[model samples]
Target: MIEWFTIVQVSVAVAAGLLCVVLGLAGRKPSDLTMGAAALVEVLLIAQLVIAIASPAFGNEPTGSLLEFYIYLVSAVLLPVAGGFWALIERSRWSTVVLGAVCLAVAVMVYRMNVIWFVQGA
Candidate 1:
């Protein structure tokens, strides 16, 4: 729930998501670039997981419903994985678009999680 880190995650997610979508719309199939973008998003989410785990010890616990925050965090972590798997299995432009869509969805979810942690709880 660190504000700066959350911003970074959202920015990266949006950038990567847009890149994939643009490429897919250009009739590109799922390639390393698209997959790599998805992977990058996953890596950020994993980092977020680690941060969440350790933040409480640092006196940075979420101010909202802990259960709801964790649910969003965990689900956001899974979206890229599922999308990547789908892309790998399909190997089509639409699959690339799907991967991009997943990234965008993750970005939204992460933002919501932040809101739950900092705004909704208040």
Candidate 2:
């Protein structure tokens, strides 16, 4: 995975999480801006996946674990895409909650990506 893209994804997820918390506190639904950010995050994740497929490296280790990589990649892409659509359809505080959940999940996915790249299973 691309380290820079991973960093960007993590930053975006944190920002989205903060936005969700603020929106939830204010009793406001998710705005288009929020959804847009989520979309941006998805785009970055796709880029990361492409980079990984092209150059799979984790701290000098060969990232040939296709199954693990694909699992994380698919989920990382799917969660935000689904959440963005679901938020648009729901358009309530629940939407923000969904976004928040997506953000949280993305964060976890990034961590998993790192582990997959940098650490060997015992």
Candidate 3:
């Protein structure tokens, strides 16, 4: 994993998460803005997935367990998807908060994945 790209992913996730959380706390229901933020996080995760799959070909291999890295990557990709679906079905402010929480969780998970890839066993 490229360090710069990982930083970008984490930054976006944090910004999106904070935005959604603030909106929800302001009594706003799930709206396009909130949904779009969640979607953006999801998109980044998808890009990370693609990068992870392709990076090894370019001689960028993880220093830690490959299985563990894939597990973290795949799960990080799922959080926004599940949160967005729940928000769509529930249509509540709390669901927006949940989406925000999911983004935050994804950020932490991505950081851990970064550590697993580049820090551990280095």
For all candidates in order, the CA lDDT equals 0.93, 0.77, 0.93
Model 2 over residues 2-114: C-alpha lDDT tens digits?
66667777888878867876775678888877787788778878887777777734344434465786788888889998998888888898788778778878878887787
Least accurate stretch of 10 residues (summed lDDT) in model 2?
56-65
lDDT tens digits by residue: candidate 1, 1-122 = 68999999999999999999999999999999999999999999999999999989999878888898999999999999999999999999999999899999999999998898788854
Residue 53, candidate 3: C-alpha displacement in angstroms:
0.6
lDDT of 3 by residue, 75-119 (tens): 999899999999999988899899899999999999999999998
Ranked by lDDT from best down, the candidates are 1, 3, 2
- Steric clashes per prediction: 0, 0, 0
TM-scores, one per candidate: 0.97, 0.85, 0.97
For model 1, the run of ten residues with the poorest summed lDDT: 113-122
Instruction: Count clashing residue pairs in model 1.
Output: 0
